[model samples]
Target: MAEQTPDSLTSSITSRSTTRRAVVGVGLGAVALATAACSTSAGQQEEKQSQSEVTPLVDTRVAFYGKRQAGIDTPAQAHAVFIALDLCEGTNTQALIRLMRVLTADAAKLCAGEPSLVDQEPELAAVAANLTVTFGFGEKIFDIAAPAAKPQWLKPLPAFDEIDRLEDAWNDGDLLLQLCANDRMTLAHAQRTLLKGARPFVTVRWVQDGFLRAHGSEKPGETPRNLFGQVDGTVNPRQEDGTIDRYVWGENVEGLTPWVPGGTSLVIRRIHMNLDTWDLSDRPAREDAVGRKLSNGAPLTGEHEHDKADLEAVNELGFEVIAPYAHIRRAAPEKDIERILRRPYNYDLPVAAASGISQHGDTAGGISQSGLIFCSYQVDPLAQFVPIQRRLATLDMLNTWTVPIGSAVFALPPGCAPGQYIGQQLFEG
Candidate 1:
């Protein structure tokens, strides 16, 4: 079993290009030190420090190391790329461990706004841009590593009947990494660097890129709208006061393997929105499909978006104000543990849409492609996400315009403390 605590994680700096280490060590070491000092004292001076003193090019940065992964609960950044990798032939437990140690070490440095100890272009690493890199293990990761430590829900989706088309290219993998940031260059650099580290042990299986409203583009608390123009994530679980603790984090779940304490499960579905055909539907039809208003995202049965949808309330015609087949009605949790925290991203494939690629294929170049990378985090996929998905798959009217082409579920561990690598508990157990 990997020990509960490791002594060497802090030392896992990517060997930054040794030739440049002399110069970079002095430069980046100061930046990392200042960043750490700021973390220790949460005061006004720290909060209101001169803009000139901080790295001018990148102002916002989410701490890379914490109790929980940053990207899951952190407000969605402007850009993201989700990549999955298949384990190379002959990889075993030891190889997996070595690869993870290197990847984890590099991820930590990049997350903290420092170049990998071996970073070639140290300048590019300076733009923190709220960069966050989160890792998840696929079901196959367990088969090769500690099979006994595998979580029950860490597998591919079951036979989903509503799916119009599914492709192997986007299906399953041995690993998953989500790279997010506010700046495109920073995001691109991080992706390239991480993939290079992973090249020896795994091959790229799929890459799905997504984005939300740019930071400051919308009001601070506003929910982002999807390509369908509906305010998505209208009913996400609250992160404060332990609501997220209850639904999204997995420390207290009963009967869980030791590997998953303080960890969670993730679902990533690439739902292709048929904009060409959706444009044919009228405003009322769209509203009926989602059970929310297009203008302000209010529930059909209520005036404001956050107003509870009166599922039982009747219209003058004696019909329920919220239609029985509406997305909201079907998606709302009917019992405890049915709710999941949704953190989805809107995806509009520039080249595919502009060039007329077929949308059914499981790739970015698929024709007429524009949709959502529908992501949700939950303590248990079976208890929280599956039932809701089944309801939507069977009868929701919105299914007419959306097709799930790619789907995956990953087991995400909690953040590592300074000295430990992620998933240390799993290996130790």
Candidate 2:
């Protein structure tokens, strides 16, 4: 990729060739630091200062070494790429350990706005944009590494025959890499670098790219809207309220995991939204389907997004304000323990005909195939996630417009300190 030259600096430099060399040099730490007492021109000092200062957008960093893995509790970035890979045949515990070390080291550097040790495009590494790379392990990984340490709930979700049209292309894998960033370039670079590092031990199984509102486009704390135009994640647990701590982090929950305190389970469902049929439905029908106001995502009987949903409230004709089969009603947790942290992203890709690459059965005679990459994190999938999914699968009206085409469950290990690699406990514990 070509380096972007600043217009201000471009005019000051003489020839294009010289300007490129100068810009490259400036980017490569050629800035001259002059004290106030030093004899340096004011313009040169200003230029030096401008080159040194990085915008917060690009400079933001999420620590790669932590108690818990990032990209889970961290605020959602504008873009994400979920990569699932299967371990190469004959990859044993020691080989897996080596693979984790390599990938973890790469993640540490990339998340800190540095390049991989073997980075060919080091220039792209500077724009971290709050990049985070999180690792997950599938059941196959444990079978190879430490079968005894595998959690009982670390397997594929129970078959939801009625609502799921499962496709192998997006299904199971031995490992998972979830990379997110506010900048697509940073996210892409991190993905490439990590995948390159892991090529020796694993082969790519599937890649799902997703996005939401770009950075700075929406106000902080505002919930993101899905492709369906409904405000998503309104019912998510908040870190300040201890919901995230109790549910997502599994503070007091028993049967939490073979990996806990700093570990969680991730459920990825690639739900394809039938925009063609959804567009045909009327406003009231749409609102009734989701049991939330289209304008603000409030419950049918409430005025604000966060207002308690009046499930029993009635209409003028004596009908329940929130329908029994409405999505919000069905998706609501029956018990406090049933809650999970949802962090979904929207994906709209060109149709097979347009892109000349067919994926699953996405040739809907439209210009694009759009859907939500439904991601949820919890301590235990069977206890916390499955119950809610069962309710939705049986009788959520939104099911008419959405079909889950892909599903995978992964065990996310705790973050590691310096000199340690992710999932180290799983192999060593």
Candidate 3:
């Protein structure tokens, strides 16, 4: 049982297929079988195999909530607690590791119900069970002499104008601590758990917390409508066997290290949607704007949401039934769309009193601050990701519903064994 490295994983995915279509057939079956077989062994072999399969494409159970019915909602809950942290002085990787170790331990304690560090802020503690901690390396994350000389692909997006604000937030302990519980009590408990360890390294940036009504009247899921009330992310990547590596990692880029081995880059954006104005657009106009259904996210050509889109479908007048420039159509054009795995959680907040006044109560009344916490994982953020986002940012009709406010790119190093912490590669370098 050899310990897997990023290089080995990248080699495995690249050596298998040349095109995205090839990812689905025999190649995927072979990988799945191989992974299953490797899982049989008792030791390192099993662990390594498991690591190889942990791609972002897998179904990650996600629940979202907002602060309208604080004591009463199910499925999803929400809170915005701004956090800030001071950077460790030197290039002491051990210090950073220690910091994370302590942080994780506190996180566990909070979730498990120790003394309850966040008891004072009951809402924060209630949301701990639904929490996930991730780390990123800034452009300066790697010290000089690190392997491959800080891959050019690792830099932040050119469109991210708020680099300073983002850095400040991260350094200031910026983290989204989510609480996934069915009842208000459970949500409150989770929040208490998270706030315990989070308090030392992070401080509240701002606190606006509450719960969202369950996804539907019957079951929990994404909001029927996006922030704009139009269904979004309907055409997201499906959770299949071998598709993770392709969607998470890039195709044929060379020299770049795979931080998380089989895992890919998770790009998170806080996209603000103009629900007030978006809700005013008529159905036909809205459909024309996005070239898809306002309900199920189906393409304008009547293709099922999950079907391979038919860009060629056109009306009798030769007008493309699905607008040629529609978000989905352009995002995944008939011939050349690169797909990425999306795991988004919805967020809704109450608008500030001042901000809420402008809408004259026409909005969700409470200044409904709802948007998609857009998280996508890809192998090469630079290649597969940036292009699509660039397109969306520049010309997608849905941009009318969304505007990216905060952004950060983190290189997720592979998951480490029990005694190990993340970012072991930085130490080796």
Task: Give per-model TM-scores.
Answer: 0.82, 0.85, 0.63
Best candidate, TM-score: 2
lDDT of candidate 2 over 1-429, digit per residue (tens): 121111121222224334444554564453345454452454465456544542345646777888888888777878999999999888899998899999999999998788889999999999878788989999988888788878899889999988888889989788999999889989888988999999998899999999999875554456899998999999988776788877888886554543556888899999988777777789999999999999999988989999999988999999999999999899988887888999999999876555333233342455558899999999888999999999998999998888898999999999999899998877787
lDDT of 1 at 132: 83
lDDT per residue as tens, model 3, 1-429: 122122232333333222222333335455566666553443344344434543221112221111111111122223222222334345355555555565545444343333344356544443332233334444444552244535455655666332112322322122333333324454444545445544454445432233334311212234344455466556654324434434554333343334445334546565555566666668888888887777777777665765555778878998877785687766872223356666555667656663442142232343456666565666667766777777666576766555565565545444334344445555554
TM-score of 2: 0.85
- Per-residue alpha-carbon lDDT of candidate 1 for residues 40-118, written as tens digits (9 for 90 to 100): 4533333344222322326556777777776787767779999999999998877877777778888887766789877
How far is 193's C-alpha from truth in model 2 (Å)? 0.5
**How many clashes does the backbone of model 2 have?**
0
Return the clash pairs for model 2, or none.
none
* Cα-based lDDT at residue 388, candidate 3: 77
Which ten residues in a row are the worst by lDDT in model 2? 1-10
Reference-based TM-score, model 1: 0.82
The lDDT of each candidate is: 0.75, 0.82, 0.47
lDDT of 1 at 297: 93
